[model samples]
Target: MTLDALKIPETPVCAAALEVAVAYCSPALLNHSVRAYIWAAAYGEAQGIAFDPELLYVGSMFHDIALMPEFDNHTAGFDVASGHVAWVFGAGAGWPVTRRRRLVEVVISHMLDSVDVAADPEGHLLERSTSMDISGRHMDDFSAPFKAEVLRRYPRLGIAEEFLACFRDQAVRKPDSSPAASLRDNIAERILANQLDRTG
Candidate 1:
């Protein structure tokens, strides 16, 4: 299925966020960001979850932005820094303070091991979807047909190597951060072994 087949949000905010991602993210990273949203929305539909598409779409776009050199932070974790960036983006998009904070929460929460879907459906979906895209975690949650179409439309483009390099660098610089913890937990192996890497 195409992205349009998934009914992706086409609001001004969604369009603007895509622009920002395209401007800053490498081609591989840009496709990964878009795939992140596609995965989340597809999973949400299959599960019958009611989530704010705009929040999830924008959060997915900015969730890994700190992986870029210009956005990387010296002290805070990449997820934390990315959260702040999304907050700023939300403000510029004319979102209220509460909504902006929710955006920040969704972006940062994607790094967590798990998020309560009832409390924050967008965060829950994003976390699960990023994990699905990166390490094939919870791959069974999506049907084989859906997974095939998503991969066909937005190929991984060797994100296995690209993302591992990003995380390895992050681990070196932010020894006390989440990426460091992930490396310690053998995330590199997981990324390399991801089932998606073997597909189209």
Candidate 2:
């Protein structure tokens, strides 16, 4: 499917989040963020899973912000720091307290091994989508045409190397962080082996 056939969230808050991501993240990182949302939303539609588009879009956009030095937290894991940033963005967007909390949950849960869709659809989608983008997990779930369209719109600009370097830095600074655990699990190989890199 082409992008025109897909339903991309275009609310004011979603636009603002995209602006922030584009302003802060590198070109590769920004494209990665947008591609993550596209994959999640498209997969959710194909699976008939109900999800909040605006929330998922916002979460996807801010999920990697903490990897950048401007927002990076020396103590907290990047996911944790990103969640805090998303929470503040939610508040600024006039979202209610519960909604802001939900945004934080989505941001943090993306780092988890799994998120039960019944419990949190947005979180589950984000987790699966990010995993697919970063490690090529569940790539067979999407049609080739759909994948091609996503790549055409948001080309991968050597994100594998850039993201690995960011995670490596995070691991060194926060040895107890989730990224450190990922490093131990050979995330480097996973990132490098991702088929998306070759497709792009």
Candidate 3:
């Protein structure tokens, strides 16, 4: 969906904040933001979650803006930058302090696998869920807590079964790769599959 189609608060402050975020991000990365925002918004909607598309869009666009060349790692960059984007965007939008803080927390906490997996198993599960969601698969081995948390956070996104199935198919398709690469390939395949299906 286009930014105009989103139901964000259309204040000047919000617009400026979005501009700042887009300015800080690279064009290619910004493209990723578009796709990510679409996925996130759709997932949230499907699960009956109430998310600000503008927040998801701007937040995700600049989530990795803080990345330094030394830390070319996607996970690490996302972890650090998500926090910064939340802060900057929240402040720029003049959001209520409490709401801003919550937004920051959400952004900082969004990148699940990028953080400590042992300490934040929930985050890991979220990462896995997102992967499965993107791949349009179902994951049979997902823990109850993980499933519950996902459903809780995204009540509008009721595609858990489909996501799990896609997740399992992706794993079977690429059994030997690292989880990150596997997730990437899963997303790529899903995109290709969508295109083929649409055209066919």
lDDT, model 3, position 177: 27
- Ranked candidates (TM-score, high to low): 2, 1, 3
Off by over 4 Å in 1: 1-4
Candidate 3 regions off by >4 Å? 1-9, 68-78, 113-200
Point to the candidate with the largest TM-score: 2
Q: Give lDDT: candidate 1, residue 13.
A: 99
Predictions in order: lDDT: 0.91, 0.93, 0.46
Question: Compared with the true structure, what per-residue lDDT tens digits does model 3 show for residues 1-200?
Answer: 23334354455755775576567644544444444444455445545555555555555545445542322334333444456556766786677787666555545554443534354332333343344444434334333444444334334232323433433443454454232344554555563343212211
The candidate with the higher lDDT, 1 or 3, is 1
Q: What's each prediction's TM-score? A: 0.96, 0.98, 0.48
Residues forming the 10-long window of minimal summed lDDT in candidate 1: 1-10
Better of 1 and 2 by TM-score: 2
Count of clashing pairs, candidate 1: 0
Candidate 2's C-alpha runs over 4 A off are none
Q: What is the C-alpha lDDT profile of model 2 across 56-101, one tens digit per residue?
A: 9999999999999999997999999999999999999999999999
lDDT of 2: 0.93
Backbone atom clashes (below 3 Å) for every candidate: 0, 0, 22
